[model samples]
Target: MSDPTPVFDDLRDESDELDRLVAELSPGQWALPTPAPNWTVAHQIAHLAWTDHSALLAVTDADAFRGLVEKALAAAETFVDEGAETGARLPSAELLARWRQGRAELDRALRASRPGARFPWYGPPMSAASMATGRIMETWAHGQDVADTLGVVRAPTDRLKHVVRIGVRARDFAFGAHGLPAPAEEFRVEILGPSGDTWTYGPEDAPQRVTGPALDFCLLVTQRAHRADLAVRAEGPDADRWLDIAQAFAGPPGGGRSPKGDAE
Candidate 1:
């Protein structure tokens, strides 16, 4: 079993950075709308808190977690928004406190999980490190929405490796979610990280390839930016198609952001 400590630490750092961004916001600012349709800054944090609570249940109690799964299955489209709505209605201070407490508890539970233990998730069973990586991916992605709403420009960090890993790993899932067949051969992915280090995945000399800055790929998979706005490029039809429909987070494919100026 891979030790989850590093991803756990990165998850903490990612959450804390987002917390700092919102911690001092005025209540009115908390109500400011973000790029996600009908979602405010409060909704972004609320969604994170709701997911952390769900993760806590998954790690601690299988039966309870299944109940959550059932609820999600029943509502399908409305459940996520409902969860965020409930939390978003709370007073800003109370909401923040709840989010902080829930995530901290989740961290402790993940750290205490037995080695090699796998927990059920909305998509598939995940080990501790995978779960932590998912959390980091989400925190960073939703934090991007909050940062955008606040007109803040956050520097890309090496922590994005977690997001990039999930994006790459989810390649097949992305295809399946879109009702497309995944290519038989793995595509090479080469990403330049913020610090000028190269991160590579799959075999070198693969016929299909993707190459880009790590930050752009993360944004692409997270659906925070439209493909047209990103510098990420693809070689070959399968790889090019993957770029169009890529999604890092689970559930149904998202209604991705429109190309810049198209929405305006």
Candidate 2:
């Protein structure tokens, strides 16, 4: 795989795009409920900001970040939601400023890290490139909540290639997280990129395959949409199970979004 620094740049660009979108919102708009149960637009941004700050700490101050991680693990069940709640309590201006600062600092810290260095995270330590990709995936996912709440459509982009790549690379982790052993046979993944070119992974002779649009695969792996709403098709038992529980981001298994036509 290519070095992900360029992809990291794209990630920062995605964050800037989201920042622009929320920068124009009114106080009432900030309060709009998002797809995440009990979380509003503010909550979504707040969570992003908190995680960005955490990522920065992970890079710049490992000891302090470890302390923070210990506290979060102690309240594992509610830690994520609690951070968002605390952040959402800030005024709109303050919240936006904090988010902007946090992301900028995170980008800088990531770039300054030594080549091939790994940073501590809630789960395993991640390289700078991996961390950047995760941040990009998260920013895009949360931005989806804001867009959906506002009834806005975000045009699909080739940037989704990064997300798709991460999803494919995380295949084993997905199965392992659920206490299932990865299948011995490698799985093939072929998805149509936004540019109309095909992006593929795994060996062509692999018995198991997943084929779909890049956007759908990205949404599925990010847990932003249910597999039922996507056009992803899987062959073989291993591929089927992977599609069922695939997650690109770190942390515990998530409760994926409901299928279309189902009440939230």
Candidate 3:
């Protein structure tokens, strides 16, 4: 694939940006409820910290990581919430320190892996580049929760290109995850990036097409917002169906967030 080093750099930059943002929050602010159900700012950072530590282990020690994954899978339903709740109980300073350390170690471990080596994940094994890009996407998505909680409107950046790429790439995976066969036709995506440049993916002449602002597309694929709230529009039956269940991250099918103004 492309040079992963730049993507790794971007991952670290995203982590650093989040670290700086959270560092400025007061204890009360850290406890502020976020858009994610039953999760606060502290819970968000804690989740990131726990996942980063797990990812570091995945890269540095495959056997141990596999065991951990097995254990987590055995307790799949509660595992995520348990980890986040446990970590969120830490003192604010300690929570921040652990998250910072986990991210740093993860970056280093991913960089040290062989160029084409794959690491086990909740879904399929991911190469170093995919792992880095996944981390960046998670960081940005969770950061959005934190930003929304604080009423901060983060300016869009080219870094979002990674998120959009993954969103487009996951089209087939999304369908298959729901036990549906992927459509035979290629789906075209045309996104207007933050910088006013058109970011296009897939064959330009494809019959299926999805078009919208890059930010809205990212939000949709990430499940951060309901499709009703975004400006994305899809043409063709396959493209329309793909948008209904598009998920950039791997997992059991997620129940996407409710539409704007809906009760939680």
TM-score against native, each model: 0.98, 0.95, 0.95
lDDT of 2 by residue, 150-250 (tens): 98888888888888988998889999989999988888899999899999998999889999999899999999999999999999988998999999987
The TM-score between candidate 3 and the true structure equals: 0.95
Lowest-sum lDDT 10-residue window in model 1: 1-10
* lDDT: worst 10-residue window of model 3: 255-264
Regarding TM-score, does 1 or 2 come out ahead?
1
Model 1 misplacement above 4 A: none
Cα TM-score of candidate 1: 0.98
lDDT of 3 by residue, 44-116 (tens): 9999998998889889988988988898989988888899999999989999999998888888888788878
* lDDT of residue 233 for candidate 2: 95
Going through the candidates in order, what is the number of backbone clashes in each?
0, 0, 0
Decreasing lDDT order of the candidates: 1, 2, 3
Would you list the C-alpha lDDT of every candidate in the order shown?
0.96, 0.91, 0.90
Instruction: Go through the candidates in order and give the C-alpha RMSD of each one to the true structure.
Output: 0.9, 1.7, 1.6
Error of 2 at 54 (Å): 0.7
Q: Tell me, by lDDT, which candidate is best.
A: 1
Q: What's the CA error at residue 146 for candidate 1, in Å?
A: 0.2
Residue pairs with backbone overlap in model 3? none
